[model samples]
Target: MQSMEGSNRTLVVTEFIFLGFSGVHRGQSFLFLLFLAIYLFTLVGNGVIFTLIQLDSRLHSPMYFFLSHLAFIDICYSSVTIPKILVNFLRQRHTISYNQCIAQMFFLMIFSATQCALLAAMAYDRYAAICQPLRYAHLMSRSVCVSLATASWTCGLLASTIHTVLSTNLAFCGANRIHHIFCDAPPLLQIACSDTYVNEMALHVASVFVSLGTFLLVVVSYIFILSAILRIRSNTGRHKAFSTCAAHLVVVIIYFGMANVNYNRPSAGYSLEVDTLISTLYCIIIPMLNPLIYSLRNKEVKEALRKVLGGLKKDSGLPQ
Candidate 1:
């Protein structure tokens, strides 16, 4: 709806259009299939990890506990954006209601922030295990692991709630089209009718505190871990120590590296095509790759998957 007050024209936008590579009909069809396959694999792969962690008694350790949480977060993080993107891929009317858009933005923030905290918590777990091996069990007690996981979830929820409430309250009496695949803060803020200075500031502050702060902690923990790994006398010992966290390090580098590039920008200002590609890579591509990274690199996860699949085959009386 449009209203003219004096010479000023204002629009009351109740919905947002998602213009995600829709112009390229053949390309859109190909992308839809590709993303569908990727999303399915992501769900199946992470689900296997989550289930194995839950059911396997030998996997009931601090590291596996955090791995389970990370897997759960991957499922959630992908769910927040992938399904909508998929629906938009199949549908002609690529639109989302204002409330739906707000909800998507809120949950996306929660999952992304929570995953950052999870990565940090996992890093600290590795630091304790590698740097302070003697006291590893004592330091990463079950209670401590639970506390860290709880704190991560709480912090993410708190951070996202602040932004979601504030961002949703912004006046959207302007362009109704969101120029990206999903509702992200940067793109959503682009169409805001109200001045977004305060919203942008809040986002920047949150990025600094929650995203950068957690990442710095991860970095520091790794520094100590690397120092400890280097101090190992035997080459085999060093390799073993480093192997314990190689999977996690790979995950952290990919997840946080892309996130920092996307979120820690100068402002919400971004090119639509470039922003969409990068966001898809950050949000969709990374989640799909995490299971592959962890399972392929970590010995424990591979064994657990083997045993789980073997048991399923046995239960079904199927030849393996």
Candidate 2:
């Protein structure tokens, strides 16, 4: 039997088999349809928000600008993995090539980390708008928004680079089974032949930054935002203030909840099956839910969408 460790004397497994929802047994078709629906909704929901934000001049503010970018990231994040899972469900095979596995992991890390930073940026936006309303416009000006977005992306790239380089250094000499639906970090590290203490250390360090650090920043931002809302004298003022943050609050809850559950806790002793389900929530379900939370709950977004659709209808009727 080949040892789990990849010695220089032996060749490591060149590929990995994704044991997707196959663990659930039976109803593969049902699960396929379910995820297919989720994927489709993710596409349309995020797409609508992105388009509405771009087209509506009223939505050109910094808050909507950041929301548009967040929607775009959600689209990319969900696309990277859901399509593969969908294909696997349809074909009854959940295998991925080693190179594909690496690519998946890279994009997943990039988008996931980017979202963490973007959430923090959004928190600051709320803090400025609510806590320092006088300078919200000046603080979140076009140049500042651009810089924040650029930094968010740069952080994601840097984090992904470190993880990918470290992951590549550790050889997966055998036991090609990935034991999950995607090329997640912990599961992949488990199969590495080299001493993975370094890899685990890096993973924990990055998780700390991306998970707890961002969560704390958001919590602080919201604390001030809530205090500001409480100080408002009028009912309409309170409602408006809460409305401005409701979508973001829901998103933060969903995102940080999944992140804390998955990364903040000890990965030890957890079943791969549980990991897969939780991964699906963060990777699939949250992306699917974000657009709905933001678009449906937001009256400004709804109005923008209505105007955009009305314009399209008018344009379609004007000429043949």
Candidate 3:
């Protein structure tokens, strides 16, 4: 089963074993059910948020616009790997094909990079709304929002293309055991039989640029936003202004906190268990909570949902 060209390595192994939560000594069944619940929440939460944003004209602004996009990416991101993991947990064996592995890694990188870009764009949106309230609409006009979203998707695709190309270039002739739930760049790179120096360099450079660049942009944007907020003399005015960004602030902290903890570590030194837990945060848990925190906590979305649900109920009664 030579999936790729010149892949005589298939003579050695047919499929690679995914050493998932199986490495955990005890509580395997408990962990499986835990992850299952998280996956379900992710689907419903993100799904509802996306639907609400699309249906509600009130959420057509850049902030909610980018948020809807984030929820979509998160839904795709979690689906790319979690369902397979859940299946493996059920069957007691975790293995993925060579082709499937590459596909998973590619999609993961694409969504991961896209999420970073979206978050950075959201920061800039808040900055404009708060610091340049006079020009909020002008700054985040329909054309401008479309441009930003396009750029985010383009950057994500380009980054994933680079990594996928580099990853597939390497040979895996030895033990085909991947010690992670999904086919991540790091673990797959480690398993390559050929020289991975180039791949590692690409990975490090991309990771550093995305992580640091996005972090810096978010911080700087918020700094200016805070400065603008503090300038308001009226306490009520200040409180009202801050309330608009409170949910965004929470999301930024949670997302970046876990990202920094997971990716900023030294590549050579890290525990597998620690990596697994961190992976759970950014991949499964964060995505599940994002839609809830952003939508359920906000008045606009709730009002819109109420109207839509009422309309739906009326239509259902009238029709049948």
Candidate 4:
């Protein structure tokens, strides 16, 4: 809640206090442990997936290429917020400096938007594999994958730059309290004393192009994939084709569904507690689940994980 007097005779906020944990009079330690455990699991799970993809030659295809990037993004996305949250859980005041808040918001948006685009790229990879197996090699060459990954990151950077730049222009005055868990655009907008019409419009536009737009891309790719799968005369062929997409489809549904709930909800009628819960699910829980979903659903990832574990066990002279 620190503020400085500006030349315009207005108080400028120097920091923000988070009210996310204000209601908890007890169980701080329990919450800390829970969040820490989930953060560690997210790190390890996604780290393992990335490492396995790098080590396993069988997993060097376009699908796994995109998956490795996804895993990397998950690790980064979770790290951007969870570490600060864990630190705040132990402190009496959940406070963040204004600069830190901006940084957090920037990185958070970058990773989130990148993941959305990356997921769409992965869907296209699946579509190419299933719908046009013969041309899959050319459609998903190494250069193509690199370009897609680069484009995803570029989109994220551009979108984040727009939002972050717009956000910096907002005058916080003396209102330095953030209602939500993290330094997202919406929460910051809610607390800004200045006009936020431009910010809100930017957010809505980014939502359409980055969130909803990527979601529609995924949906369209799946439609073509489904039609392609249906064309296969053999039942087993259809099942195999569908199985390849099942994991990514589930991930797309969960990510976009939670995103819509977290972002697209009406600003009224929802309590702060509900907002906090949805943010936790969308930001904290989803990253941890992504790797688990992929590992559990994909036989190749599981096999690669087993091989790595076995190699480690053998190197340590442990029982097979």
Highest TM-score model number: 4
Arranged by lDDT with the best first, the candidates are 4, 1, 2, 3
Give lDDT tens digits, candidate 1, residues 225-314. 999988889999999998999989998988888898888765644676777788889989898898898888877888888898899999
- What lDDT score is found at residue 56 in candidate 2? 85
- lDDT of residue 258 for candidate 3: 83
For all predicted structures, in order, the TM-scores are 0.95, 0.93, 0.91, 0.97
After superposition, which runs of candidate 1 have C-alpha atoms over 4 Å from their true positions? Answer: 1-10, 268-270
Clashing pairs in model 2?
12-173
RMSD values for the candidates in order, in angstroms, are: 2.0, 2.7, 3.0, 1.3
Q: Per-residue lDDT for 89-178 in model 2, tens only?
A: 777567887778888999999998999999999999999999998998899999999999999999899988898888888777667777
Top candidate by lDDT: 4
For candidate 1, report its TM-score: 0.95
Q: Rank the candidates by TM-score, best first.
A: 4, 1, 2, 3
Poorest lDDT segment (10 consecutive residues) of candidate 1: 1-10
Residue pairs of candidate 3 with colliding backbone atoms? none
Which of the two candidates, 2 or 3, achieves a greater TM-score against the reference?
2
| Candidate 4 C-alpha lDDT tens digits along 1-320 | 45455566677788889888789869889999999999999999999999999999999999999999999999999999999999999899898899999999999999999999999999999999998999999999999999999999999999999999999999987888888778998989888888999998898898999999999999999999999998999999999999998999999999999988877788662787888898999999999999989999899999998999999999999999
Taking the tens digit of each residue's C-alpha lDDT, what string does model 3 give over 1-320?
33444635244345678765767656767878898898889998888888988988888889989988999998999999888888777666678888888899899989988888888999999999989889989999999999999988888899899999998887786568876778878887767778999988887787777767887899999999899989999999999888888888898899888877765667673667777778888788899889778876789988888888889989889541
| Candidate 3 Cα lDDT to native | 0.83
**Candidate 4 to truth, TM:** 0.97
The 10 consecutive residues of candidate 2 with the worst lDDT sum are: 1-10
